[model samples]
Target: MSTTRHYINLTNSLFPLPGYAADGYARIKGISALVTTFGVGELSAINAIAGAYSEYVPVVHIVGTPSTLSQADGMLLHHTLGNGDFNVFSNMFRHVSCVVSMLNDPHEAATLIDNAIRECYVKSRPVYLTLPIDMVQQKVEGERLRTPIDLSFPLNEQEKENYVVDVVLKYLHVAKNPVIVVDACAIRHRVLDEVHQLAETSGSPTFVTPMGKGAVNETLPNYGGVYAGDGSRASVRDRVESSDLVLSIGSIKSDFNTAGFTYRISQLSTIDFHSTYVRVKYSEYPSVRMNGVLRKIIARMGRLNIGAGFKPNNTLPAVEPESSAQTITHAWFWPRMSQWLRPKDIVITETGTANFGIWETLFPADVTAISQVLWGSIGYATGACQGAALAAKELGINRTILFTGDGSFQLTAQELSTMIRHELKPIVFVICNDGYTIERYIHGMDAAYNDIQIWKYKDLVAVFGGVEDKTARTFQVRSKTEVEALFSDKEFSAAPFLQLVELYMPKEDAPLALKLTAEANTRNNAKA
Candidate 1:
């Protein structure tokens, strides 16, 4: 039985809907559902769904099409492009989704639904289903409803897993300095427990890529900082690159994730543990998976000799040098965020400056950070915040926070009204730079195209129907002193209601990581 929450009648666009589903999946670590009309609506949402596909988020996308009889008769549909083809939209979605099912037969509807959902869960990607209006009420099997769909991943063959583990141990045991690098797939595959056990048992210095920011417990003594090639802090870069053995867990080496493919670690010294395979040096074991292999490796940790007397460096780069200018710079703001965040909070960052800036922010324990680093849609964080907030509310989490640049927030600002309608109490901090800061760093430093029309960002809550002093509140802070006071406030920290903070920062200043990445991006684009 599905319980209907109040309908969100004021959705501005379909672009943010997939962000909601993707972030909901992130929070719950399960599949999320999205419903759209047949043609026009699904096309508008395809970009974000493709983003979910790129980042490995499992979202079940259901489309409501015309009746089966209408599609069969080739009737002209209102949402169609004045054509008789009904499968045009589904055909487009095939490139982005794991499974695209059209429920035309009542006998196979249940099996199709079950298979679609199971594949979505197992693959950690979106699946599309077209349910005609006529088939909504069709009864297939009540017996199938009694048995829940099995959502387990296939276990690796024990013999192959053992061989892979032995090969891994051979490298791990001999290396004087072995470090673990956890990436986004570790979180998507639900293997953080195995990751944590391996890190703890081996006592190795563990680092995360930019996409893997919150995968490990940052408060742990063995935790190193974010490692993104030249974008990383000098200490972290040297530590990771100088290691004798690298155990990369669920790594996704995208251009942005690795600072434009700037990783210095060699494949010969790295053993990669993936969802479906294990690569030890140059040899690949196709059937061996990470979760089981990690478990077996942990069982034999007594034979490992690495990670002894390896002091971990988790400190932020010096902040006072850049923060002393009275205005809140990216350098100061991100590191200061480390002090403001609480344990178990859900933090969503936009793809612009906030995405790279967050690399410097050290999270408290069990914090979940959501960002589209690979897909990198500009306004994705605002919509994702809504879904993450809804999931957090359902899970009884106290706080959900969003960090977005002013330019990106404008693209999906209408989602704020949805947040108000749902009465979700999330703290939103809009970096009120005058333009697209990340783009400026990448290419157009002085171009007019980079500038934006600055709005009264703090007034958005009131414009979105949030009652002042009750369901919502707003603040504008410029100086470091003002930001410090705001962060120190007990009531504000508790997040009793929806709060918006218009944080003003220098337009040209960006995080160290973004600057390094943009330089690499510039160099790459200039290459022949």
Candidate 2:
């Protein structure tokens, strides 16, 4: 509602900037805004905008266009089509965005802008607005800017909410073993506190999907591991599938999220809590949203039967005491990284190996994990890292870390320079595995299409306008010992300046979840 000017880091490409806005919104818990020029600039960033819409991040896209007189006169603007139609680009955004507003009229511009942003927040999707050149200078009422937009959701009807809560309680009271499965929308809709209270108060085994990595506190006693049907660890999968009731919160059952539609839980045994509705065993209650319903359920629930519900097995698989001389593998790297992560650190993972590999990581309390699991956009994490770092800096949260693959990093590597210009310090790990490992798993294991040119990734800091020892530093860790040594280094761990590590792993190596998901995808593709 209220706008403030933050530091804008200009980048070479428009593609990654919207990604920055997406994660910035996540970190700051508010709608993030980005501006683009008409047609070309807006079109270039549409992919990222669609990714935001897919992943439920609220972003406001303001586009600068030609003056209204020019449009009225049918003058062909350089960025527009030859036919002089300026609405074409905005039309394309309608499919992805929840709201699109064109500010051709100066009188209604303020109201349109406010309503657009409100819709963006309420729906947790992107909104598109266009401002022409002459309209930009027109005097609008400053009185409206004094009051902030009302971003609160409409209150659920009291009778319907109580009835829904009562029905949910009935299920809870009679159920012997009920488990909670948190997913991506729980984070997107800002319902973590309600989710945490429900999980802790109910004492049910709580698990996260791959997309819901950091939705709940992992250190809790009832914290089960990530559940993605067949892709899950055997103990976790069996525990969830055998449960009498499953409370699925804010779930997005995408292909990768559900391990290619392999979820075994039946609708009869499941209750779904979404942003706008709540479902209990086959019956759904519309206009009964999750935030209030969860809060009411926790309040009304006096006791839970929870008979013989298995305790969460949070123990990481034991590995042989690794030496610095040993080669770094996914099995060793992921579990070790869990130990390295600090509380409240913001960890951003790329859609390649890091996204799937992160399922093994048991995050400490308040750690924020950001990734595009549903959208599955490559090279998004790097640009998101910049925006997250900026938001982190503003909020006084230290240590924004990024884990990206070599191939994916190359797509938006220029954003690193933007971080350098803004003097934001983040620990970046570029997993140099030679090619697109995820693609290799699904299709060709050794095909030419999967290969990428090798770059000295460590040299990128200097190439991107970063000073060697003052503003930035770089390192290459080839073995487990090297990784351990770097992690143990006080200077590196302190994250005083921008740091990039070329983390070398085998080209053919992949996380367990990725392998399982790839196999499922392959089989599904062969079906029809």
Candidate 3:
């Protein structure tokens, strides 16, 4: 057996090497199932690492911490050095990770690490393993070193097969108006083939949750548009709510994505295949293990005499094409966008008017919409665009396009530095309204705080150290003709280009998002 040594020389030594290497490792591998003591101060790096591995990538994160002695002694920390240190980092990751464990004994480290990896890979979620600094130097007796365990395929095979067959049969036999809601899990599980097969064989209309926007090639004929609050196509929403069976494969009912639990589908009739549990809400379906279940369902579906639904009636309202704007309307901006897009374009939308408006008005099967729905973080669009663009580049796909409100762009515009540094050219379409249109409309807050300091967006790209000729470029468009000309231009399609198309959207344009925001504010104000 080949053996290797990890010598931990100093207290701070571990931090710089393993800790630094861990981030790089995760970025390269695109996942983290291990946890480290690195906290919020390390967030930008951690998020950058996590973002690098995001969307179905399994990462094993292991965080190292000060020993129990340091914690008990209450040592002031450099990285938010703290008393009760373990809990501090644990809490920080709780929201973002699938599972977390703090390792107290060096002997159990191997087992814990194995378990974390197994869970992360199986669930396709970020898992964390925290090692106390004291454990780092502990020696394992050569004889006592355990055999490396492979926790891969933890699910019982026969049982998993049976479960998959059963679900498939259920879908084939029972539900009319069946729809499949794809989420990030579908991609992580590498189940795109299965999803396409199910969609094709079942001939069921498929709608992607916001996170699952590109789960299936949006170009498919059966592709129903995205289903989110006001963004949902009315027919798709009706079909989802009214369906006899809603197959929510890898979909999470997180608050942000669901518009605060607005959809009316009873959890009972829903068949949820998650990373951990297989839940059938209607029959009080006993939650079972996930793996073989899906396989079995596919097998059973092959034999079932289920009738295919009629060719999907594309009876949905035509998204009113943005008539070439004699003047700017949210409606006009999207159609111009739709006209510009080719198949396989990646479009990232920030949260607010841009998300609510542009996403609803235009339907580009090729566009990949990226947003932090669970967090609803405003500035996330820009950072997420960076990640999406990097993902596109790594996959050798189309250059990404980003739509950020003038307000939202300012929050993480610094990420433009990272974009330029990486030589990722994304067309940043900035809707230059003067204020936070969503907030102003929602709260009826004519508040001055909602108004932001404006910057000439096209000029800022150069200020952010973007290369003039090869790396980035910018544009400001006031009228529809200008927008259309940019869309039709073949030369702008090339990489390492940043086109900042500036549009003077009226504060009144995003009525729906504004209205929802106002109602939410009223309720919040009432609660206060």
Candidate 4:
């Protein structure tokens, strides 16, 4: 019994896979993979799958592209012209994947495909193999077309282990207040257990980057919340700046997420366990197998004479008063929302005005889940909310809420159909100010371009297949009283409901962080 499924995408006009029926082939059990092309919307479909099943299933991608003849001519190509030509398609996904390659020769096809699949299984990340369109039907010599790909972790030599151990141990000894920063890589790599063990052993506070929001459950004593940009907690900022040693596990310093490299933590004596090699400051440590290095470090840390020193000091900076209408509304809204939150209810916020304000407000200790994408795509929240809601359902938890801006929500409004289809209920609060409020704030633009066409919030649910006036509900609240009333009603909190609360947020009501961002944008625009 074969456990792997294969999906072939040759056009019917073109030659189909020989002796293989396309129907029911997509239904195989254990290790399934898909092969398609860049121009055929396969990348987007694959990405959706990757986002949907990031931790559990691994996907091996084989994409077909135009021949080298077309590449040399630089002809206008479909889906291959974005972001600095065809090469950037791979570069854009580099952070999300472990490996990607383009294969031109028909002779190398079998070996390349075999290796790509093996790497995908081993790394537990989506790996890619781009083949030219001309090569799909070409005659190949030597091996069979259906050769089995091995999925196994190769053993590392003793010398490689010793070298990695020495470097890690030396860094541990030199710094007094060493903190471990974990990112999405830790979760993707299934190293959460190891990370927890390492943090407890070192007695250091574990700070997670935004993409690594739930790296360690917020309930843990040593788990410090997100540390990046102006939204970072004051204590976290103080700790990062003052720490003598910073050890980053699969953490990259990207611009937008890091607030343009505002963190002044010196890289001296820093150790980075990146995907390619182990790096310590300016020096590159030789390539060592990651699993071996992680295991050895965890083992050595367990033997160290370290005591738990992480203490939760929740004191935040005193709120400075701002007289904008937006500030006033957010100030009132956040405190009330904070008070209403039960520790069990999961809150997923979109990355716009809501992200800025949510970070500023106080919530019940460890009650919220914010999906901070490093890519900073606007529509990320809608899909992420659906994913989080599904996750909550699997855990048998009810009452998931999504707070999103009107502009951001517009990007993935189609996802509401998915929400209705899956029967996953979430209370969605749309801050409908009738425009891209964040962009206006950032650009200091009081122009008409930022404004968008307004729609009746309640009518959208009916259009998207929700049960009329029963399963789905929408509310438009302009004042604090209406906001309180909507939540206080039992009918509103019931199963599989969608409530679109319209709050009349002013164009001038900007948060402090957003005000700073606006000023920065204005300065940049002036320079341009």
lDDT of 4 at 16: 15
Please provide, for model 1 over 1-528, each residue's C-alpha lDDT reduced to its tens digit, 9 standing for 90 to 100: 132221112122456565454545444546677777778778878887898888888888888899999998999879897789988889999999999999988999999998998898788888999989899999898788777778778898888888888898888889888999999999888899999998888888899999998999988888888999999988789989999899999999998999988999999999999998999889998977799999989998774655443444324446564445788888787887898899999998999899999998888898999988999988888988888887788778989999999999998888899889889999999999998999999889899999999899889899999999899989999998999899999999999999999999999989989999999988999999
| Residue-pair clashes per candidate | 0, 1, 28, 1
Which consecutive 10 residues in model 2 have the weakest lDDT in total? 5-14
User: What Cα-based lDDT does every candidate model obtain?
Assistant: 0.85, 0.86, 0.61, 0.61
State the weakest 10-residue window (summed lDDT) of model 4: 18-27
* Candidate 4 colliding pairs: 326-509
Q: TM per model?
A: 0.96, 0.96, 0.76, 0.69
Runs of candidate 3 with Cα error greater than 4 angstroms are 1-40, 43-87, 90-118, 129-153, 156-164, 167-171, 188-190, 229-231, 267-269, 285-291, 302-324, 361-367, 511-528
Model 1 worst lDDT window (10 residues)? 3-12
Q: What's the candidate order when arranged by decreasing TM-score?
A: 2, 1, 3, 4
lDDT of 4 by residue, 1-528 (tens): 243544433221111110011110111112334455565445455443344234323555556677867765776876666432666666665655566767877777767767776676566556667777777788766555455555546656778667877878887876677777887666655566677778777667778765565566554677766676454667777777677777787775654345444566677856777544677776777655555677788787644433344554334333522333323266556545655566566676676777656644434543545454444456566665665555566557676777778887776776677677778777888887777887887653677878778877667888998876666777778765676687687777664565555666666565555555455545555774
Quick one: best TM-score, which candidate?
Answer: 2
- What digit string (tens of lDDT, one per residue) describes model 3 on residues 1-528? 122211111122222222222322232234432333455433533553344244444556666766767666667866664454547767766665677777777677666766776666556666766677788777654543455445455554565546555655665576656677887666666566677777777666777776676667655676776665443556667767777777888876664455544567777667877655667764423445444566556545653233243233322125544343366666556645555566667767777777665444445454555554444556667766665666566667767788889998887777677678777768888889887887776554578889999988878788888766657777777776676677667877654466666777776667353355346445555764
Error of 4 at 386 (Å): 4.2
Error of 2 at 67 (Å): 0.6
Better of 1 and 2 by TM-score: 2
Reference-based TM-score, model 3: 0.76
